[model samples]
Target chain A: MSFTVEKTIKTCRGKLLKLSHNSAALNCKMVLNVYIPKQFYENASVAKNKIPSIFYLSGLTCTPENCTEKGFIQIQADKYGFAVIYPDTSPRNVTFPKDCKIDPNDWALGEGAGFYLDSDTLENFQMGTYISEELPQSLASSTDLFEDKIDFLKKRSIMGHSMGGMGALNFYLNSFERNSNGYVSCSAFSPVVNPTAVSWGQNAFKLYFKDYEHEGKKLDPTLILKNKDFSDKNLNILISSGDADPFLENQLKPQNLIDVVTKKNIKGIRVNIEPGYDHSYFFVSTFIPEHCEFHAKKLGLINHLIK
Target chain B: MSFTVEKTIKTCRGKLLKLSHNSAALNCKMVLNVYIPKQFYENASVAKNKIPSIFYLSGLTCTPENCTEKGFIQIQADKYGFAVIYPDTSPRNVTFPKDCKIDPNDWALGEGAGFYLDSDTLENFQMGTYISEELPQSLASSTDLFEDKIDFLKKRSIMGHSMGGMGALNFYLNSFERNSNGYVSCSAFSPVVNPTAVSWGQNAFKLYFKDYEHEGKKLDPTLILKNKDFSDKNLNILISSGDADPFLENQLKPQNLIDVVTKKNIKGIRVNIEPGYDHSYFFVSTFIPEHCEFHAKKLGLINHLIK
Candidate 1:
């Protein structure tokens, strides 16, 4: 369960660590980036009050490198006292199961397109379990990595971009009422909220599972939001979508989730359609401050000088 | 000449416009990125109050896209109400002239290794003239691009990373007594200050010209600083070098520049050796706000709210 620290680069007021470790959930060695904030460095050994965590799921065809380098989320992570987790979208450098089907050519389906779900067919692509369950359990005991300076069980939020946006929303919705240590808030950027409706999701769902009927309905955010229980869980959800995102009309379909939230009268879910922004990291970096503030409030950070 | 806009993306309080146009100085078509700040969009038509410009030069094997995507300079540019011009390292889509002794295989010799200097051997790579003279003149009449909203000739500062850092320092020093339209200040991150004494600089100088003593001495920052006269010019120079930078000891040689600044009793030039930093955009992005503020003060921009 011990993770190997591959590279540690100093950024902002913290350091971005490139880590690799074995995962029993997905049965492979996994690599991910974790941006440990300035607060941890301020008191590494003194773990009296651990820094809260925020997991940032990257979009399709992306390694942990994309958002870690280009997204500029580190600035916001440091601004708040939250550690940012940049988990890989899919398992890599591992042999796929013989029973499951995969596309070698299509970047939209195979390697980088885990869609943050447990594969109904095989254990090879069980990223939903890996991210939401196994990864957390591993990091809980990862003393060598953080010196127990990060509180992974509590005061955390989930976020993603494009396909990742879908992952964040679905995880936030489905993982609700699990425990008191559940996600405090959720956020996304140009996310595909409805996987059953879009082509990108349809193709990924078709391959990740034998059929969409058995598993897809439970994972789709728009479907879960319809019958979601907000009585106990605080629905502090923030979604930022670029109006100029090319996939907005077809793939993202943020309107689907908005319509459900509207019909059900869901509170505390804000959707801002940013003008002239695109699906690039430029858009994500632009709205990062606002998103950080959104999560920081839910995480109960009282900052006057910074955020 | 007319410029073609490849793409325009909204970020922060501004838009990053990817522009391509013909450069007579480099004898080819060139592509550059310009981040037009929010002040321009506030009233683009009102050319009365033109926005000051900052030209950011990139390092080895980098296009204009590298810094634009990763540097996060646009955030600072928007904060201070100044446009950032990301010019190409060298001329693109052009045929190389005969007898210029260009190494097609070496990235350090040709193409990206313009080193911001006029070639003694050929007109094919006259980047020194392109950046300092021709680029400014073209932008002056570029109504279609900026609509005279950018004060290209006046209120401008030059800054860069790695090799581009060396270029910025040299250009600031050489172009000091040109006119009232000269650069107001200069700054860099992990720059090759003493290029004449380093392998990276020595290799680039030999290939860019027929001899080192004749051309290299003129283009080198360390050489220029020795015989420099800062009588009337405002010597607002800032250099940030990382102690952990792999190239710091052998290549950058900041000690060379420090010696001259110390013995010559130069003022207003501050060199900061940042601990635990490296030669990546992570370092540059982290320090971008400080650099922007340094340039803003030189360009006479007073922003109590932001920079």
Candidate 2:
């Protein structure tokens, strides 16, 4: 499918480009924002060496704009000299049932919650493949992005908020072995840690995974982490949750992953539970810079500074 | 009328209080968020000394929350030792004709753009007096706010963005002489310089001032400056406009004030037309700290370092 760059501006010491493309992967037109670090613009050879990249996934009902506006990740990315990509959660033209009980505008289900999984039920919801495979490939093929700007050969890190966070974890776990570098690191905020235990996840999983007999086994990150076998790639895992987050005990139980990691003796997982933050972007913005810097260091783009 | 304190929390350095009150001046129920600096909290007597105060008026469709969320003003306020008061634009419950051809949901018209003028036409829109008179009087009378923490006798500074910028300028020029020790400083971003020329201001002013005799007289900061017989009072006016601001040229012509002040020999007006910045909060946040410090020194709260 062909895509066109809409607008590009130099900001935060990087080039931010908004692009639109007709996607067979998404089955509709979609838009995404890509931020190429000044390392690419200033020194073209760094990108051709395939410098490390990070993908930022946004939460439910949000568009590519939210992360750009409130996430405050660009500043950190600029400091770390890493490329950042933000993909919209879903395509346009998909209509939910009016009596679907879930209001279409509720932001949790219909639009912004792609959940980072391949949908076998909904005709249009093949976003998992689009993000993990096709979109990355497209980004790699485009000289404007990859030739001298991004080092496709380098390791990559993924992180997101709410649904996007769940998507990041699921994508990392599912595709951990495909890339030669393996999954470098992954993190999430207010993620649906145990999808089988929550209402939003339940409704979304039912819509996307319908008749898959491996239902409980497939979408749950904890279950996947336990059952999937792979060489320990030295993945640095960071998870932050707000104790005061209204959904922490219910939808976003960080304890689920903690329990599994403890049983499995996973070595490098770091979980920081904050005291009084909430589920809003205010909470996310406060910590997102740290996450970006964490991944940037793991991917070998920047040295971590002890502040 | 009686008012109730809704909530208060001790932030890292200071206290934040949300108060609800029946505003007889505005003729409606109103809410305000007041942040008292750490100095005032430590020494109660400082507030009664009439220490300098800076009032921040928010733009269209925003409440106290917008400034709190994105403004990044607290750190500067702490450094400068100033109290920050954010008052809502206007009360709800005013009705407009359906054919007014304005989208009621648009942030500019219905909810956020109070225009900071008493509405002679709408029964509910007498917010101008509330902001200019009653609100300040209430702050002065409330011993908890002004007794030892704020020195009303000291010079005052005012600043704002978009509609709020217009409000600050109007209020500063109109009422600065009577209530304030000096118009120490004033600044704005993308302010409606000529209300008679812009759609947002035209619609708001038409509804606010029903009598045509006051046409182009009330809430027109440039007009007030040109026609009113008032001394300059050595007000330190630092006005900035983003050249790339979408509203510039049409609504926020900083040149208007520059042209007037240049001809009138207004000694303290400093106009800065920034290049490439837009109308977003990023632009405001970048320069807001400087403006605060500018006022802090002028108000005698802090001694100016000899440059």
Candidate 3:
């Protein structure tokens, strides 16, 4: 995919830089914001230290800019001294059916719904490869700002909001656990747990995969947990859901994963059901710090200063 | 004025009930989002304890919803056991000439430019009374949510971003010298320090006040500091501005206040010029916790829980 490196600003500590990159990753040229912590900037000798990093996936139809724009993850990342990578969900080049619908109810399926899965049925959607594999490799190999900053080997975690939460879980279960350095932990907010059952998920899944029942299992954490034997890896899983979330009953049923984990005795899964929180960033921002701290501890980088 | 009350769910918290009231004072219907700390719901009597509170004022054209929607203050508020009150800017009943213009250059004067001052020329724009006096009274008298729960007389600090920063500073200066019940420190993000000098301020001043220069002094901290004797107040002031802020040279000239405070040897004022930061919330969120801690210390609230 063709891309353009736009601008880079060196933060106060001089150890981190906020770089904005415009890329034609999926199809439409997208703006991706990457926060490269101070470590890579200061020590060019240790550039290839292969520090573990995390990709913060955002919800449906959200450009990489939303997380950078509204989400305050950069502060926490600075504190944790980790690189934060953000990528857009879907390329805007391709148009889907009913793309212009304004109803919030239809928001989950159309524009924002990349589902973070590889599309087997459609030609345009290859986001699954773009994010999990291609994006990481590009960042690692390119001489751009993120080259030495992203350490995919040491330790890593995956987290997101709404549809991004589903992406985090799907990526963690399907690929990150097997490929990356080590799985520290994964957390999500108001996530769609059983994608095969919900309408939002059904629509996106049908568009992405051919055989719904079989292929959907690979993307559904609830289904994957029933058969995948990841308990031996000591993965620390934290899921936060607001009971008052408008999509809770219909789309984001955290209970689905709880039931699976309970039945299988999943070792390191903790679900926090927040009583009054909804599906907005307010809910995600509340618990995001805990997730960062969770990953920092396992990565053994909690006390490590950015310099 | 008519009003509506909407209950919202906060992640891991009990409930967030918003009071939407139309304020005849400001000629605008305002909404305040109140997050009743989990402690309040867990213990019914805690509601009567007169807990410490913080008032978050948003910038031009923004309602109480902006901070709640994207700012992520509630999460920290919940963790710190403090009640957060978000009051809208000006009333919607009155629309100025600069409302809803698409040009970025017109950002300071138009739809988003309430300036947080009482308009002497425009009868409808008495927003100063709304924020400083009427709003607090309404919070205490009309709502059970804040009446017994908030010690308006005890621990309190005001904060805001952009135009809201100007409001927070104005409110603090007016309220702090009197040794108001909850006179804690105050902070601002990319605040408009000299509203009289910039185009945004000039346009807003002409619309709001008959004597632009003299009335402009009421909103500008630099102008207020010349006549006001804050030497004895022991008020804490934290002002953060980005070196790269697009408005730095024109509208939000924070250096104006810094120069005054430095020359006068202002004891309690602390100015943080964060390098590489801009006019975005990312800049604000980075140092917001420091401002919270600053207020928490003076308010005698527990800061241990935050870390």
TM per candidate: 0.96, 0.81, 0.86
DockQ of candidate 2 relative to the true structure: 0.18
Cα lDDT for residue A196, candidate 2: 72
Index of the highest-lDDT prediction: 1
Off by over 4 Å in 1: A44-47, A96-101, A177-181, A303-307, B44-48, B93-105, B177-180, B303-307
Which tens-of-lDDT digit does each residue in A195-225 have in candidate 1? Answer: 8998998888888788776688887888887
How close to the true structure is residue B150 of candidate 1, measured as C-alpha lDDT? 90
Q: Give the clash count for model 3.
A: 15
Task: Identify the superior model by DockQ, candidate 1 or candidate 3.
Answer: 1
What's the candidate order when arranged by decreasing TM-score?
Answer: 1, 3, 2
Write model 1 residue lDDT over B90-174, tens digit each, in one string: 8776666775666788888688888998887767788888888888878878887788889888778899999999989888888
| Ranked candidates (DockQ, high to low) | 1, 3, 2
TM-score of chain A of each: 0.94, 0.90, 0.85
lDDT of each: 0.85, 0.72, 0.71
Better of 1 and 2 by lDDT: 1
Write down the worst ten-residue block by lDDT for model 2 chain A: A145-154
- What proportion of the true contacts does each candidate reproduce? 0.88, 0.02, 0.40
Standalone chain B TM-score for every prediction: 0.94, 0.88, 0.87
